[model samples]
Target: MSLDIKRPNSNKTKKKMGFIVKMQLHNNNNRGGSNKRNLFFVFFRSYYRWILWFFLSLYFFTSYFAGDQSSPSSTTTTRLLSNHNPSSSLPSRALIESSAIVTPGIFSGMKIYIYDLPARFNVDWVTKSDRCATHLFAAEVAIHRALLSDSSVRTLDPEEADFFFVPVYVSCNFSTSNGFPSLSHARSLLGSAVDFLSDQYPFWNRTQGSDHVFVASHDFGACFHAMEDMAIEEGIPEFMKKSIILQTFGVNYKHPCQEAEHVVIPPYIPPESVQRAMDRAPANGRRDIWAFFRGKMEVNPKNISGRFYSKGVRTAILKKYGGRRRFYLNRHRFAGYRSEIVRSVFCLCPLGWAPWSPRLVESAVLGCVPVVIADGIKLPFSETVRWPEISLTVAEKDVKNLRKILEHVAVTNLSVIQRNLREPAFKRALLYNVPMKEGDATWHILEALWRKLDRSYRRSRVLSE
Candidate 1:
């Protein structure tokens, strides 16, 4: 096991090299090298997040908040306006950037290309609804003007449309029924519109009409007779059931607002009436009138659902308090109803044939706390507005106990509730004022429809996979 070992030439050369290296290190440490290294680590541990956050925030803020508003038709600005605080003049770039992730520009620059529906669908449809100052005709006017005037929403080209607006005035056509077959005209018009859409664009056929918007704002029993499969009044065909339906009478048991496609929009207010409500101040802002009701009290005994008068809510209220000192009751529509609404501390809004009533909007507009008696009714925009804050809902069966319910609301509490109703935000909710008015009824409904379509798209993608 012999091994040959070579002895070190390291004795002279290795020792000299090590000594030189050690002297260099000692000289560097003496000149504060260790202090500089520790100081560098200290700074890194203390302020790195603030530095990183500042740059990341800057990138996103410049991208979203500074969106191209100069494009008069830009939806990007509206989307940005919705997600930020209304009073926020300028938020810190980081705070806004954090929110930008969740509030995405899904519809930025997206166009709502309204179909140039035949004159029958629009102007002619106006004649059918304009005979009276009611919700159906009012809706014809409101929905039509909102889309036509809002430059930010409409696009002249169908090819660029993100969502198609089908101006199907089903309620307006149905308004002409006089114990005769008036539903035929509306049904024929709607059927023709659907046929035209199917023939003209692959959009309806490809999506099965899921991307369309139909404003069928009528009492369920009054319109959409197609749900019954009636040949004459069946305006909304079964194939188009997937489209977004906007109406006021979306009862929970029937319409079930929890569903994806049904949107509960505000019933129309006459332009003059809205202007009048907006022009005058309430008298003393006091509950001088204990309660007020002015409408038909006749019950449709055969109509047991009591959507309008079948439930005996009106009859019960009239029977119990018809001549009460403080409660004012009118058996028919009165001329001073608007003034009465402003005077009343609580306005009685009983069901007629549906859970929703136009009086809900009227009362809110005039700064009266709405005493909603619609059973199983889902209030419109309830996702954004808390109903109980500015209104009260008594069970349809509790119509007789209306006074007791009002009694429970303390005078102090009633004042607070009235104050809530008086808010410009609450008033804004009850009316589809006009175009370019942010956060009004029409704006909320369209925004809701956009969200519905977005969710539907996501769901379909997941299913396809």
Candidate 2:
């Protein structure tokens, strides 16, 4: 707060010293401030860099780990082919080949023989007509095709072919009052036929101990009955009874035959094609009530339509409701009829004299709600599938209520119903060929029998040794 002055020389020295001391103090203070500013900047820079690095590392690491976890494994790619191989307990190619071989002819390796029957069999309803000849010809054709495919098959005279494949008419003596064959009679006839063939041909002598597989296009019960009766009549050992594989289309437990493996082949129509066909058909309002019965009624004089109901009941229903709804007789090739059924709210499936018909498959394929009339007739392949889960089963007495039920369905949501019926079993039945799919079931049972037979054959060989 006070200033002092001095002599010139002493004052000059004092002033210089004082100036030097003041400069040194200011320089010290400036150095301290600079050090503090530099330290603050270094701390700030390191904190920001650490945060950026942490976030970058986290983002990259998370993305890499996520990609690894989301990828699928190789095991999922080959799952479909896994169940089809013989090594996995399925039929081997050798077994199928041996079974398919026509005796007395060349011993060809495994091959599938497709038998195409003449259209006449479909047309002929009565027995002893040219239809029987057609049936025999169809069988012969199948055998011929099999032999032609393989040069190894020894071609004998028509009477002496190594194997004879026959398509027994659905109307044979073995069948019931309905056109379907009787299981017991069918089995007996088949057994006798096999024996007759064995006695007639020398080639079958070696096959006696071995198992043979046969696929019949007739109903399942007929096939089973034939096989069972054959085993008993031939005095086939108890062990060998299970060795025969018979593939059939229908299944009924009440029949005397055992339940062999079988497959249900349903009719199928492509969805888009069906929709387009329906668009061209006449409106439901425009269809005449008596159009279906005009001409065909004479051909089917008993007035027995294949399904729906008996002639008497159908007549009553027509009389009562014919004015309200049109009833058109369905031709197999009618695209419009198929489309109308496909687009309909409900499809009526009254059992014919027979419980199982092609119509059931057709209805399911169309995605139409099948209204099943549960009658005394036993359903084919009912053991393998649940009818109610996919279809609406109505009692025979309740047949009159079909219209009301359909009306109710129209008010309900249809997409949900379609979704419910589209199961894997239904799809497989619709897509695959009937005889081939039946052959697959036959293959399964035959494979098991073959394994047993092979073991027996091996044991006999060892005993002989």
Candidate 3:
């Protein structure tokens, strides 16, 4: 096909139309219009710029329409190409859009709706005492505070929630006598909260509190008692039997206190305190004290209601290794005990009133090899932390051979255990951080809850729907 554009400046415009009107211009040599044909050819040669401009315009026009037809495919190709080429000068629009989108984390759409209970249920006690948030039994407060600030797994919409969190600060009612948290009001407070939830929302009633989660960071968990016999007799609260509990109390053996579905969590120790200990720690990592223990190592462990404190384990340790060389055991409390742990090789983690103790977390976080004497005690975050690789476990009966065991481990794998203790992950896994850092105590609780999504009424309903 041919195109002819007229020129407005000269008489050549009239001659330009003559080429279109005349058909046999190629064979017009015998005709009298040969001059016209020659004139047309001359005019065409002089203004060749118009032909070039027309072809250029047509190429761009076709390209514009073709590009519109295949834009989606072109964008995908650009993104794929850009990903493989790290030195790409310009980022694709697809990459920019994807980067702006908030992707789901490991919880996989797991959403927990925390109850907006009254201040009496949680923060009222913290307002009264700063120790409420930092004490060993403060995991209840720690987990609640961490979950409140967490945006990843925490949701405000109750209708779409997978599980409900009841944030009751049960461990904050400090007794006036010994300054330890009193469990006298724990059961009643928790029971009242359950009653309040059942009255206010459909969630508690829908699953009979099965999909709800509570933190029972006490000696005997939901049983709300420090003594084993009483804790056993009382068992878990009748209302909280189906609910999940995140407690510091857990035993490997079958126990009434842990009868409820629960996740064993480490007792709360301030992350700042752990950081302070790390800051003041020795540069050479030299441990001066060999086989250190600083706590109530009793000469005669008192028998309270037929059960001896620590089951007579601490007393046995005191009787046998109290005056021995290199055995630094203290019967009195010291404010700077964490300093002693930082300078210790083997920190004793003998059973207190309960099997689990804050020393398990304290020793591990401070890079001390914990000589755990609590048999059948379940440590927190066991799935994430290899406890056996980092700490030693001694039976209550084997307290006599404790020195021999430590000596043998020192000769063999003490360095190996210390190296494992120095890992930041093990420390991070045991502490609760606000806003819920990954692999932290609060995060591990969410992981444990994720495993129990089978009991989530919302999840089951959504799957069926």
Candidate 4:
């Protein structure tokens, strides 16, 4: 019985034991691997969601800030014409082509009417008897030529013109006459003319209305004062009151109209004429016998001493250099070719009716050193130009010293001195050829007014919409 029991179930028991051990080991490995995989997936999913949200927020904030910074910081660029330098080099054809003294778009397509009455207004009298009138006429002519040459400008009859320019020469005092009694009378006439035209053409009132711009070239303050008085008497319209532009070439009286824009045009010979005069000039130390002061030899009523003082200086110069330099005092002519005399090494510019005279411009153009008797004459364009480098202005009390200075300049190298006078800025004035600083002033003022008017029109249109 013991032998039979020992061998009974060995094979069956061994096989069952092997199968249970293998199954338990396999289940344990599967559970451990599944736990590891689940833990890794949970950690990765959480961090990925956070990273995606962070990137989205960063992109949105950066885009919003960048857009906010770009909207308001904008500007415009404008090109300015280059200044001319006569001393450095000759002007190129392109520069010369681009060089226009007055730009065309300044008038905004408005036609300018210039009234010239040669019969009632004597051209000979202006050239010979009235120096002031002569200067005014010259300035007007220069402006006229500039405008006519410009393709953008159109000269129309006063009746058909968009802008009317009238130059009235008055001789009588304000106390005299009835219809043209005073400067005020002239202004009233002007105002009446505008009103009349407006009544005839309704568009004139609708377009320009009381804002009509007027430019008047008067002989002196009598006209200017008269206009102001008339404006007061007639009660200036709100629009036309401030639109008057007055220019007095040689007025002794101060202006009463505080609001009016006043301009003074000094006498100036054109650069081309000055050049011709220089070319005709004699070589160093040679003088023409007929060279004399043209125009009026008499002193200006306002400058009595200037007349006598200038004559005395001339006498002294004649006495000293008469024999050697051929001192010729023609009554009012400088050898018929005034530019030649101006082209000479020295030019004597005594005090005249105005502080700054055309002589300064003439001297600069001719490359001559002007010996100015600095007393009452105020220089034109002092704001933008340097006088010391351009001319020799000496005190009226220092004529003797001035003479010595001129003598020194004569002996010094003239070419270098002329070069100094021919700076770029100064040359532009010459090349563009302004008769007086007042011309430039008027141009700039008108230009500003036009721009303001244009802006207002644009704003009104925008608002209407």
| Clash-forming residue pairs, model 3 | none
Poorly placed runs, candidate 4 (over 4 Å): 1-136, 153-241, 244-259, 266-272, 282-330, 374-378, 385-388, 407-417, 423-465
Question: Which RMSD values do the candidates have, in order?
Answer: 11.1, 19.1, 15.7, 18.5
lDDT of candidate 4 at residue 430, scale 0 to 100: 37
Residue lDDT tens for model 3, 372-448: 99989998866545787789999999999999999999998888888877766668778999878766778778878
Residue 347 displacement (Å), model 4: 1.7
Q: Which segments of model 1 are wrong by more than 4 Å? A: 1-107, 127-129, 132-137, 174-185, 221-236, 254-260, 277-283, 299-308, 455-465
Model 3 lDDT, full chain set: 0.83
Worst 10-residue lDDT window for candidate 2 reads 73-82
lDDT of candidate 2 at residue 203, scale 0 to 100 = 32
The per-model lDDT (C-alpha) reads 0.66, 0.40, 0.83, 0.45
Can you give the lDDT of residue 353 in candidate 4?
31
lDDT of 2 by residue, 1-465 (tens): 888986568677667756765665667577876555555554466478888899999999997886453212212211211223322576434323333322221223222222233433322333344433232112222322233344333233422232323333333332336533344444454455456546665433564613333434332333332233343343322322433333323333443333432233332233344446547545652322221221111222252233333433344344444545544443235535555555454565654333444455556655666666535434433433345446666665664765675566657644555654554444333332223222222222222333343334333555799
Q: Report model 2's TM-score to 2 decimal places.
A: 0.42
- For each candidate, how many residue pairs have backbone atoms clashing (under 3 Å)? 8, 14, 0, 14
- Give residue 268's error in model 2 in angstroms: 9.9
lDDT of 2 at 8: 67
**Per-prediction TM-score:** 0.71, 0.42, 0.77, 0.47
Task: Give the higher-lDDT candidate: 3 or 4.
Answer: 3
